[model samples]
Every structure is written in structure tokens, then in C-alpha cells.
Target: MTGQLDVIREANLGIIALNRPEAINALNLEMIDGITRALEQWADDEEIRLVLFEGRGPRGFCSGGDVRAVRQAVLDGNAEEADTFFAAEYRMNGIIARYPKPLVALTHGIVMGGGIGIAGHCAFRFTTSEARFAMPEAAIGFTCDVGVNFILSKAPVHRALTFAMTGVPVGAADALALGLTDCAIDPARRDAVRAGIAAAAGAARIDAALGALMQAEMAPVGEAALCAAADRHAGLDWTDEAAIIGTAGLEPQLAQLALRSPTSLIAIAESHHAARRLSHIGAVLAADLRLARLLCRLPDFAEGVRAVLVDKDQKPAWRPNSLAGVDRSSIRAVVGAA
Candidate 1:
């Protein structure tokens, strides 16, 4: 239990380390502000050529946003707090996407939702063998946002759709295959790689330096396996919405979403399709804001959070309870109908 964030200015690297082991480094509004400030300052600093982010302990880099807090805000009738949080978080996502220098993200343990927003947009994304990654907003009665659709859009379309719809966890090897990560390495040599990155002063030198460090730990032992299920779905015709809806790869998550806010599932699906044709992540962010604003006005987001977090009871009696009956018109209201 170090501070929630440790902002260290090394000789060569600006380290924005997440230190909240207790909460698995789950981000809140204050931490988002700190990170945005750190990056904005480092973007202008001439001495620092690279920025690196990582988390502490074995629990992982980050679980996601502090949605429990957002749920609290909704319960208190202060909707501005949740809206403000999303605005700030999405802005931080933009900064990470357009960072001027080489941005390195070390992903260990679990990285989901906001965690992916922070690390996935970096120039160099490094994942340990133990890393688990996903965009799991569907399970929480929240639609996918934070520019994830941009990343998903650029990846293999069907595979990306499966992940967006389903909340399945992808391992380090699957991430590499999906082009989500630049390097996959054993968790043991991470500290050495960090030391080398922090010691180098030139941004141009990071490419080779990081590559060499990754090479040291690329052994076959304990490496994560490729996501065969996602691969199976990727080869299918995703244009058929029925195929996606009935995908075996998505079975586990389908059940979860059914018991959740089913309308959010529709929003997530539409957002993925909307981002598929866009070039910039800015468009994705805009769509996210639209969907988020509408979802906040709905009841499911709060009810889902209450059942999952506040009460510790896993039963969220969702308003339609099933996706079959949720109308497309309602889903469109969240994502904005084209």
C-alpha cells in the first residue's frame, strides 16, 4: 500500500505508476485527474523522452473504473458527478492516444475497461504471461466506451465483435495475436525491463531496448495460449447478426448479459459497428459520451451496480431481463441512430 499513484520523474522516463494494490488500482475521478496532469506536463518536458505506466503487487495493473462510486453518485441524485467523471476519463483517453513521446504500458495481472483505456492506447504495450484483458462493460449494465471501439474496430472485425459483446477474458498470447500488445514477456524479467527503459534517455532508443528486454523472457514455459475461441469466431461471417448473437464463444458472457441491463448490450453492439468505419478515436469517444449520457438517465446502470457492488448480491433484475424483447429503437437512443 503505497500511494494511489506514484508519479516519478526519472532521468529518461516519466513513470506514472498505479499503487493501489488494495483496490487493484481501480481508477477514480481524482486518479484520472492526476494522470491527465502528469501526461500533460510530461508532454512538454524536454528531459523526459518516454512515459511508462505500471501497477503494483500480483493482483494486476487495474480492474477498471470505480463504478461503485459512480453508482453512489447516481443514488445520491448528483448525476453531474458521473457525467464529469466520464468527460475527464475520455479526455485522458485522448491524451494517451496522441502522446508526443514513446508511451510504454506494462500490463500484468488483470487489465479491463478503464485499464485498457490507459494502457491499450500507448505506443508500446507490454503484457506479462499472467495478464488478463477484456472490455467487460456489458456485464455491468454499462455499454463499452472510452474509445475501446477504436481499438476493436481496427482489430479483426469478427474477433473484435465477439469481445465487445461477450466480456470474455483474453490472455497475453491472445492479446499479441489480436495486435493489442507489442511484446509478450515472462513476468519474472519485468523489473529488469523497467530498469532499462527508465535508464534510457532517448525516445528513439526505446524500440531496440525494449525489444531486447522482451527477448530475454520469450521462452515457451508458462506462456499464455492463443484465444482459439475468438479465432473460431473471427473466421465466421459476422455480417450475420444472428451468427454473432448465437456464437458459442460468447455463450458464457451471453448468460451474464441476459441477467444484466440487456439494453446496454444492444448499445455495446451498436457502438462496435459504428466505430468500424471511423478512422479517428475521437469519433468513438463522442459516441461513448452520447451512450453514457443516455445510460446514466436509465435505471439499469444504478440497479446493476447496486446488485453487483453495494449489496454483494449477484442478482440484478434487469428491465427486460432478456435481449430478445429489447427494441432496437431503444438501443439506438443510446448510441444515436445513424
Candidate 2:
């Protein structure tokens, strides 16, 4: 109703809540602008020492951007309007990445695409066992944006490629292992943890407060064992660090992704590969923006979105229909060294 955001001041902490829970708090342009403007204003306010970002929902923190709507904007002949959304989103994401004070993201349930870009940069990120994390854009003929490569760079490259190609969601344990989240908490104790953080003194005490509450529920055991069992079932060799997904017993996921746009998958994988050599977030985001802006005007993205979200057919007639037909140079051009 308000194109709203919930702001509360407690102690020296300023809390920002993503108020749209029904849509899994999926960010729209208005929400992005609202939150970004708020953070910029908060950055200058002396009384606010720390920020706790949250989503109001029983299911997950945020699913991602309302990009299906953005695609619709483009279809309605307003490509620049669509571009404005990404620009604002990327700006907001960058602000979060460089937030001056202690910043904590309370994440649970589904966090993917733009959700990862926002929370991934926070200094203190907490997720529960219920969290499901992924990039997941390639499935809709787009690559992950907002410098996802920066996070993926800190993760295992092969696993990142597999994630890009297959859109497979990972759990908190795996996200922790992949450098996607800082801590895992108990789902039922989320409110208590928020109360603890709110009562915490400035930046220094935030750690102690979160750590105290971080133990309200111990991390579940067997994350590694769970991954191992899945790997074994997939007939993947866990020991070979050099093994790629195509060789790592992920044949089923790969085949499933074959139903999507192959060009998008390759672009994502290539971006991850290129990002490995870059160390700075600014550089990574610049590259991501370049690639994302380019992908926006392309045909497959709209087609893929129509098939996956609008039509619910789960069948997209992707150009370069087969992986073999996907042009290597064109994919490279999308995320290429300029």
C-alpha cells in the first residue's frame, strides 16, 4: 500500500525490514529505491550505529527481484524503465556491500538471484536450516547480476559453475561452506535473536549478542555427509578438485538444464571463470553490469521467462537449441575481457 519499508530505531540500532512477505519479499523497483534511499540516509545519521535487515514472512527472506515484471516492462516497450530497475538494484546492492557500520542480514527460506546479491555482502548474515540459496537466473535465460561473481569467486569455482548451469539450491551448511552465509540459526528462535541484536550496544557488542543468540540452536550435523551421499548417488568423485560438473556425476541436473537456454548457461559459467581472477567487488560489479545490461535486450531472456514463469510449461524453445550449437565466441563476448 505504501510501496513500503518498515523502519524501527532501537538502542543505537536501526532496523530495516522488507515488508512484502506475501510475495516472499521479492524486491520491486520501489522497494529497491526505498531501501537504498533509507540506507543512504541512515549512513549519515550519527545515532544509528548498526543495521539489522530483515524480511517479514513465514516463508524465506526474499526470493529475488520481481524480474518477471521487469520483462513485462520491456515487452511493453520501456526497455529503459527495465534498465532503471537493475541500475537502482545494483546501486543498492553496492551500498550494502560497502556498508560502513556493522550490518546483519536475517535470511531464511528462499534466497536466490537478487536476494543473494543483497544479503551476500552484509558483514553478518544468518540463515536457518530452512534457507535455500542459489543464483538460479540461468534457468530463466538470464545470468546472476549485482556482482554475484564476487561471492562466487570466494567459493569453489566448479561448484559455482554447477550452480549456474543447474540452478540447484544449496542449504545453510553448504552456503556456509560456499561463503554465501556467515552463520546459521534456529528457525523458531528468530524473534529472540532479533531482540538480542536490538538490545546489543553499538557495533562491538553486536558480535557478542549475535554469538550468544547464534547458539540458541546448534548447527545441524552431517552437511558434509549429506553432500557426500548425494555425490555418491550421483556417482561423482568427491576427491577430484579438478573435476568439472560434466564429469562430476551431475549428469541429471545438466540434462535438466538442457531444456533451458544454453547461451545463458555458458555466459554464467564464463562470468564465474572470469571473476576468479578479479579480487575487487567494484571490478566484479562493473563486469556484471556490463553483462547484465547486454542480456536484458536479448530475445532468449524474455522467451525463457515466458516459458518458465508465465506459461508454466517448463519448456523453452531456446535459440542455439543445443549446447553444441551455442556459439562459444558469442558467449565469451557476453562476459568477455574488454
| Predicted model with the maximum lDDT | 1
Lowest summed lDDT across 10 adjacent residues in model 1 is found at 219-228
The C-alpha TM-scores of every prediction are: 0.89, 0.88
Candidate no. 2 TM-score: 0.88
| RMSD of each predicted structure | 3.0, 3.7
Residue-level lDDT tens digits of model 1 in 29-93: 88899999999998888888889999877899999899999878887998888999999999999
Superposed by TM-score, candidate 2 places the C-alpha of residue 99 at a distance from the truth, in angstroms, of 0.9
- Model 2 whole-model lDDT (C-alpha atoms): 0.74
Instruction: Write model 2 residue lDDT over 116-137, tens digit each, in one string.
Output: 8888998878887778888878
Q: Measured by TM-score, how close is model 1 to the native structure? A: 0.89
| Each prediction's number of clashing residue pairs | 0, 0
